[model samples]
Target: MTESRGQAPRSGLSYLPGEAATDPDGTLTAIGRSWTWILGSAIATLVPGVLVLVWPDETLHVLAVLIGLYLLLTGAFRFVTAFGREHGERVPGLLVAVLFVLAGVLCLRHPMQTVAALSLIVGLTWLVSGILTLYAALAAPDLPHRGVVVGVALLGIVAGIVVLAMPTASARALTRLLGLWLVLLGIGELVFAFAWRAALRRGDALPGAAGPMD
Candidate 1:
C-alpha cells in the first residue's frame, strides 16, 4: 500500500526541514582520506610515551622536561588534526589542544614546581583530555569505532581521578601512570586509524550523520 503524503516513512527515517542529511559513506570516506594525519598523531604520542616508561629512573627535572615536550607536541598535533582536512568538529579538538599546550608550558616553565605538583597537573590534564575526547566521540556520529574511543576516554578519566585522589603519591608512581595512560591513548588512536583504513578498503559505510537524529 502507498503511504500517505506528509507522513513519516515506515522505515522510521525522518528528517526535519533545513537539517543536514546524514552521510555515513561520506564520513567514512573523509576519515579514510585523513588516515595519514591520524596515524602520525598516534605515532607522535606513542614514541615519547614509550621513552617515559623505559627511562623511569630519570631525574625529576628530566621527567618534567620529557613530559612537557610530550604534551606540547601532542597538543600541536591534535590542533593541526582538528583543522585538518579530515576532522569533523573543530571546537572539541581545539579545547583539548589548548589544555594540553597549557599543561606542557606550565611544566616547562617551572620544572621544579611541576615535579612538586605532578599529581595535580597530570590529573587535571588527563581529566580534561578524557572529557574532550568523550565529547568528540559522542558528538561526531560519523566517527568509526566510537565504542573504542569511549572506552579509551573513560580509562583516561578514571586514571586521572585515581591520581588526583592520591595527591601524595610519589613522583615515580605519577610518572609511570601518566606514561601508561599516554601509551594506551596512543594505542587506541592507532587502532582507530587502522580500522578506518580497513573500512575504507572494504568500502564500509560508517553509521550515523552530522545531523539530528533520523
Candidate 2:
C-alpha cells in the first residue's frame, strides 16, 4: 500500500530487509555514519539519574537543575542524530529533540517549582515522546529490529505512567522514583543504540552491499 499523498509523512531512521544491499552506497553510507549520538543521549540521561540518586539530600532546586541539564544535552544529541537519518524519516527524532529542549527550558526556568509540578512536566514529556516513537516504529514498515524499537518506546511509556500515577509528597520520594525510572530508560535506550548499530553492520555485510564511503 502506498502512503497517502496528502499526509506529510512520519519519519525516523529505518531500513528494510535487503534494502541496504540493493541501494548503491546507501548501506555503506549508513554504516559509516556514527551511531554514537544515541550512545551519548543514553549517557546524558544516565548521568543525571545517577547524580540524583546519589545525592538524595539535594534540594528540589538542585534536582530541577540537574534534570534540565540532562534534557538540554539529550536534545542536542538527538538533534544531531535526526539530521543523519534518511530525509523521509527525520520528523520523529526532530520532534523528540524539540520536546526535550522545551521541557528543559521549563525545568531550568523554574528550578524551585514543587514536586508535583516537576513530575507533571517530566511525565508529560516522556509520555508524549514515547507515543511519538512508538507510532513511528509501527508506521515504518521497513524498520529493522522493530521489536527493540517498540520495546524502548514501551519502556518510556511505562516510566511516564508510573511517575504520573505515583503521588510524591516530597522531594526525596520523587527523587527515588524518577531517578530509578531514568536509569531504566537510559539502559533501555543504550541497548537500543547498540542494537541499531548491530543491525546496520549486518545490513552492510549482506552480499552486493557497497563498500563504506570515504
Candidate 3:
C-alpha cells in the first residue's frame, strides 16, 4: 500500500520527511516519550554531586570511581537516545555517546591515575562540551532563551580553559569544583526535564502525539 503524504511509515521507527516539521509539537520522538526517564537521570546525578560536596575529603580514587559511574550512566542514556526511535538528527548524539563511554571507561580503568591526567581529561571534556554547546546555540537560531545558552557556553569555555591552565591545582580543589559543576548541571537537567514534560502534556492534543512511541 502506498503511504499517504505526512503519514507515518510502517517501520514505526521514524517520521516521514517534513512530518515532524508540520507537527505542532515540533518533533515527536522516542526521546520525548522518555522524558520521565531523563528527568529521573537528572535527579540521580544530584546524589553523588551532593555527597562529594559534603565530603570533600574523600579519597581521589573514590571520587574517580563516582565520576566514572556518573559518566557511564550518562553515556548509556545518550546511547539509548542515539539509537532509539527518535525523529531528529543523531550524529551529534552518537559522537557524544562515544566520548562519554570512552571517558567513563578510562576513568574506571585508571581510577588511581595522577591528578594532572585526570584534570586534563576533565578539562578536555568541558572544552568539547562548550564547543558543542556553542555550535548548538548558533545552529538553532529559534531556540528559546538563546542568550542564556550562549552565556552558559561562554562560561563553559572559560572554565575549561582555566582548568587546563591550572592542572597543578590541588586534587581536593579540583574535586570540589567538579562536584559543584555536577550539582549545578543536575539542577539544570531537572528543570529542563520538567519543562519538557510540561510541553509534552500541552502538545498531547496535537496530531503528533498520536505518532508511534508518543
Per-residue lDDT tens digits for candidate 3, residues 1-214, read 0122232222222334444543544333444334565565566567778988999898879888887887777666655544432234445555665776788899999999866776677667656766765665565444334454455456556656877887878888887877776676667666655544544444321112211101
Candidate 3: C-alpha lDDT: 0.58
lDDT of model 1 at residue 105? 94
Q: Tens digits of per-residue lDDT for model 1 on 30-130?
A: 33235555676678677877988999778888888877887788777666555422234556767777888998899888887744486688778878778
lDDT of model 3 at position 69: 83
Task: Score candidate 2 by TM-score against the native.
Answer: 0.78
Better TM-score candidate (2, 3)? 2
Query: Residue 94 lDDT in model 2?
Result: 79
Query: Candidate 1, which segments miss by more than 4 Å at Cα?
Result: 1-33, 84-88, 114-116, 203-214
lDDT score for candidate 1 against the true structure: 0.62
- The reply for model 3, stretches above 4 Å from the true place, is 1-33, 83-88, 141-159, 204-214
Candidate 2 weakest ten by summed lDDT = 205-214
Better structure of 1 and 2 per TM-score: 2
Cα TM-score per model: 0.73, 0.78, 0.71
Please give, for residues 1-214, the per-residue lDDT of candidate 2 as tens digits: 1221121112213343444554554543243234455676788888888888899788889989998998888777766665444555667777888998999999999999987788888888788888878876776655656677788788888878888987565668888888888888888778866765665555431111111000
